[model samples]
Target chain A: MNKIIFYNIFRFIVLVFIQVVLLKNISLYNLNMPLLYILFIFLLPFNTPNWLLFFLSFTIGLTVDIFSDTLGLNAAACTIMAFLRVFYISITVQSERLETEVTPNLSTMGFRWFFFYTLLITFLHHFFLFFLEVFDFTAIINILIRATLSTLFTVFLIFTAEFLVYRKKVR
Target chain B: MNNLWRFISKYNALFLFIIFFVTSIILFIRNNDFQRVSTLNTSNQVVGVFYSKVNNVIKYIHLDTVNKELVAENMLLRNQLKASHFNDSVVVNTVTDTINRVQYQYIAAEVINKSVNSRNNYITINRGSKHGIQKGMGVICPTGVVGIVWNVSPDFATIQSVLHQDTKITSSIEGTPYFGPLIWDGENSQIATLTDIPNQINLKKGTKISTSGLSVTFPKGIAVGTVLKAGVKGGGSFLNISVKLATNFYALQYVYVVKNIFATEQQDLENLNKTQGNE
Candidate 1:
C-alpha cells in the first residue's frame, strides 16, 4: 500500500512535469497536442475510493490549468472524465478481476480493453476541452476536427508509453 | 432523515462529481476577468519560475534562429540611424526642441511559455509589474505585433496573444485611407482577418497592413501583415480581407511590452469630451 502511494506521488510529479514542460510544446500543425498526463489517472488502482479518484483528477487538471493559464477549463473536463471512468469500470470489469489486477494497464488488461478505454476517455476529454475553449456553435466543425485529431494523437502516445513499460508475463 | 442519509452515502460519488464539476465551471467563468484570479495563472511566482528555468534550457536549442532574427532587426535599426541619411535641405536652427518628447517606452522580455494551438492562446513572459509591465500594454516582437498584456504578477506577465478570438487590432492598409479592426479566425495562427474596410476600394494582394495608432495600445505604422485575399462575402458591404500575419508565433522567443506614456492623458481628454457632449 505504501509502495503504491509513493509510486503515485512520483508519477504525479513526473507526469505534470512532462506535460507542462515537454508535451505542451509538441503540437502538430497547431491542432493536435498529446495529453499524456491523463494516463496517470488511468493507471490508478481499481479499488481507490471514488471521492479520492475525483479529487486526484481535479487536482491534476487544475495543476495543468495553472501552468497553462487556463484555470478552470482542464479541471472541468477532467472531472467529467473521472465520472465516466467510474461508470465504465463498474459496467465492464468484474469484482474478482479488480481484486487480482489491482490496476488497469496494457499489461494487466490486454491491448483490446486498454485501447477502447483510452479511446473513449481521450475522445470525451478532448471534445469537452476544445468545445469549452471555443464556446461557439459557429465553429463546431473546426472544434470537432481538432478534438478528433488530438484524441487520436493522445491515444497513440499513451499506447507508446504503455508498450515501453510492458513487461512480458507480469501477471 | 435516515433514508436520505443512506441515499446520500450510496450516491456520494455522484454528489462529489457534481460539486467538483460546478466549482470548475465557476472558476472557468471567473477566470475570464484578468484581475479576479491573478494568482491562479502562470504569472504566479512558482509556475513563472519553473517555466523560465525550463525555457532557459530550451532557448539554447533555438539560439541559431534567434541570433539571425536579432541580427536582421539590428540591421533595420542601423539603417534608420541619422548618420545613414544625407541632408537634402539646408540646415536651419529651430528653438522648439521640446517637440520630440518621448511618447512610448518598451520593456524587453523573454517568452517563457506560449501556446498557439488553443483557440484562446496566451503567452507568458519573464517580465511583470516589477519591470513596469502592466495590463493592456502592447507586446510586439522584432517581426511584428504579438499581443496585449492581460495579467501581471511580480516577475511574470500573461499576454493575450493576437491569435485569440477576442483580439481586435485597429489596423490600416498602406497607401489606402481604409482601416479596420483585425481579428483572428481561431483557425490558423499564420492568418488573420481585417474587417470593416468598404468593398468599393480595389485592394490588391500583398498590400501592407499596419497599425493605425487609433488606440493607445500600439504605435502607428508598425507592420501587422500583408493582404493575402480581399473580397465581399455573403453580400456584406465590407470586404473580407485576409492578412498573412508578419510575426511567426511558433518561433517567437522574445518581445517588447510597449508602455504609452501619454495613455492616461489621452484617455482623460476623451472622457472629458464625452461629459461635455452629454451636457
Candidate 2:
C-alpha cells in the first residue's frame, strides 16, 4: 500500500514535468496539441480509493491548467474522466483478475486491455476538453476535427511512452 | 447514526465527484474575471517563479529573432521622429487648444509565456503591478495590437490575447468613418473577423484597418490589420469582413502595455451618464 502511494506520487511529478516542460510546446502541423498527461490518471493503481482517485485526477489536471494558463478546462475534463473510469473498469475487467490486477499499466493489464482502455479514455478526455474549450455550437465541425486529431496524436505519444517504460514486460 | 454513516460510506464517491466537478466548472467559467484572474494566473508567485525559470531558458533560443524585432522597431521609431506627425497639426490657438494631449503611456515587457491554440488564449509578460502594469491595459507588439492585460501580480501579468474568443477590439478602415468590433473566428490565429459594417458600404479588399480609439483600452489609430476579403453574407445586412492580423502571435516576444491615463475618468463619466438617464 505504501509502495503504491509512493509510486503514484513519483508518477504524478514526472508526468506533469514531461507535460508542461516538453509536450506543451509540441504540435503536429499546428493542428494537434497532444496531451499525454492523461496517462497518469489511466495508469493509477486499479484499486485506488474512489475519493482519492477524484482528488488525484483534479490535482493532476489543475497542475497542467496552471502551466498552460487554461484555468479549468483540464481539471473539468480529468474529473469527468475519473468519474467515468469507475463504470468503465467494472464493465471491462473480469471479476477474478480485478483482485490480482495491481495497476492499469501496459505490463499489468496486458496489451489488449490496456490499449483499449487508454483509447476510450483518451477519446472521451479530448472530446470533453475541446468542447469546453470551444464552447460554441456553430463550430461543432471545428471541435470534432481538433478533438479527433489531438486524440490520435495523444494516444500515439502515450503508447510510445508506455512501450519505452515497459518494453521488457511486453514479451 | 449508524444508518447515516452507512449511507454516507455507500455514496461517498458520488458526493465527492460532484463537489470536485462543480468547483472545476466554476473556476473554468470565472464569472468575475478580475478577481479570478489575479489569483489563478501564471503571474501568481509560486507558479510565476517556476514558469519564469523555464522561460529564461527558452528565451535564449529565440534571442536572434527577438533582437531583429527590436532593431526593426528602433528603425520605425526613428522614422516617426523624422516625420514628427503629432506636432505638425497643432494650431497656434491661445484660447482653445485643438490638439488633444497624448492620453496613453507605454511600458515595455517581454512575453515570458503564451498560448495560441486554446479557445481563450492568454499571454504572460515579465511586467506586472510593480512595473505599473494593470488590468484592462492594452498590449501591442511592434507589428500590431496583441491583447488586453486581464490580470497582474507583483512581478508578472497575463494578457487576454487577441486570439482569444472573448477578445473584441474597435476597428475601422483607414479612409472611412464606419467602424466595427474586430473579433477572432477561432479558426486561424492570423485571421480575425470585422463585423457590423453596413452592406451598402463598399469595403475594398486590402484596405488598412486601424483601432478606432473608441475603447478605453486601445488608443485610436494603431495599425490593427488589413482587410483580406469581404462580402455581404447570405441574407445578412452587414459585410462579412476577413482581416489578416498584423501580429504573428507564434513569434511574439516583446510587447508594449498601453496605460490609458483617462480610463478611470472616461468610465466614471459614462457611469454618471447612465445614472442620470435612468433618473
Candidate 3:
C-alpha cells in the first residue's frame, strides 16, 4: 500500500511537470491550459478526508503556481472544484463509494453523468484561471471568450489523459 | 447556543461557497505577473528539452517540403544579387523589402509535426544544438513569423507558434512605430489580432506588421503578417487590429531558426532599466 501511494505521488509530480512545462508553452487562441496535471486531483481516493483533500489540492496547485507564477489562482480553482467533486460523485453513481481511488470515467459511471460532471467543473476551473490571469474587467466578453475556448481545449485533454491512463484492472 | 449551532449546520454549503470564493479572490490579487514569469521561465527551460525530441521524429517525415523552401530562398537571393549589381542603390525587392539593412538572417530548418487545430499550437523543428539552435530564438519562413523557440535538445528544438494560445508578440505597423500586442484569435488560424495600440494610432487594412524587438524572443523588423482589419475597441483606449500571418503553417516545410548574437547582453540591459525604474 505504501509503495502504491508513493508511485501515485511520483506520477502526480511528473504529470505536473509535463503539463506546465511542455503543454503550457503550447498556446492556441492565447490559451494554454494544463490538462495532465488536473489528473493528479482526479486520481485521489474516494474516501480521502476533506482536510487532506484540501491540503493535497492546495499543494498540487501551489506547486503548479510556483512554476507558472500566476499567483495562487490555480490553487484556488483546484480547491473549489475538488470540494465540488464530492457532490458530483454522489449525484452520478450510487456505487461511487465502492472504488477508493477510481479516476473519473464512463466505465465506472455512465457516460452521461460523467460527461456532465467533467464538463461543468472543467469549465469552472478554466474560467476562473483565465480571468484571474487577465485580471481586468474592462473586457468582460474577452474574458468569457478566453474562458470558453480554454475550457473546450482542457476538456479535450482531460478525456485524452483518461483514455491513456484508464485500465480495467484497477489494481 | 443551540440556535447558533443549528444555523451553522443548516447553511454549511453557503459558507463553503463563500470561503472558497474569498480565497480565490485573495489568490487572484496576490499573483502579480512578473514573479509568475520567472516560474514560467524555469519550466520553459525543462519542458523545452522534451519537445525537442518529438520535433526530430516528425522532421524526418517532412524533408521534401523543407528542401522546397530552401530552394526558393536561394533563387530569391540569386535574383536579388543580380539586381543589386545593376542598380547600386535600389535593389529588386525579391528577398526583402528593406534594402541594405540586413534586418534578419536565415538558418534553414525543417518542420516536423505541428498542431494548428488545437487551442495551443506548437511546432517542432529538426535543428537543435547539433545545428546551433537554442531557446528564445525566433523562427521565420520566407513568408513571416513561424514561432519562438521554447526548448532545445542536441538535435531538435520546439517552438511555441504564434497560433498558440496566449502567445503574444510586440509588433508595429510597417510605416509607423505604434506598438501593440499581436495575439491569435481563438476561432481561426488565418487571422491573429493586435491589441493595446492607442486609439489615436490609425492602422489601415493593408499595413504590414512586424516584430518590434520589445521582447527578447524576436528581433525587430522580422515579417509577421499584414493587417486585415482595424478598429477602435469598445470603450477601450486602443485600436484592435487583425493580421493575416504570412507563413502558411498548414503547408509549412523548411524554416529558418534565427539567433541574435547579443541577446544575452540586450536582456540584461533591459532588466537593469526596469529595476532602476522601480526604485
TM-score of chain A, every prediction, order shown: 0.96, 0.92, 0.83
Report chain B TM per candidate: 0.94, 0.86, 0.68
Best by TM-score: 1
Each model's backbone clash number: 0, 0, 13
- What local lDDT score does residue A97 receive in model 1, on the 0 to 100 scale? 73
lDDT of 2 by residue, B1-279 (tens): 999999988888778889999999998888336455447668778877887888888888878888888899888888778365556655767666468777899999988888877767888888889989888889988888999988888898989899877789999889989999999977788899999998887777788999999989998888899999998888799997999998888888889999999999999999999999999
lDDT of candidate 3 over B1-279, digit per residue (tens) = 999989976755446555665775676564342223232322344434444455555456567766777788788788778555655566546565564655445578766546564444667666776788876778888777888876566665667788765578888887877888888855677889988887877666778999898876777887888989888777887888888887887777677887776677788998999999999
Q: What overall lDDT, based on C-alpha atoms, would model 1 receive against the true structure?
A: 0.90
Interface root mean square deviation per prediction: 0.9, 1.7, 5.8
Which parts of model 2 are misplaced by more than 4 Å? A169-171, B1-12, B31-38, B82-102
Q: Tell me how far candidate 2 lies from the true structure as C-alpha RMSD in angstroms.
A: 3.7
Cα distance off (Å), candidate 1, residue B149? 0.8
Ten residues in sequence with the least summed lDDT for candidate 2 chain B: B31-40
What TM-score should be assigned to candidate 2?
Answer: 0.90
Instruction: Enumerate residue pairs that collide in model 1.
Output: none
lDDT at residue B169 of model 1 (Cα atoms):
96
What Cα-based lDDT does every candidate model obtain? 0.90, 0.85, 0.68
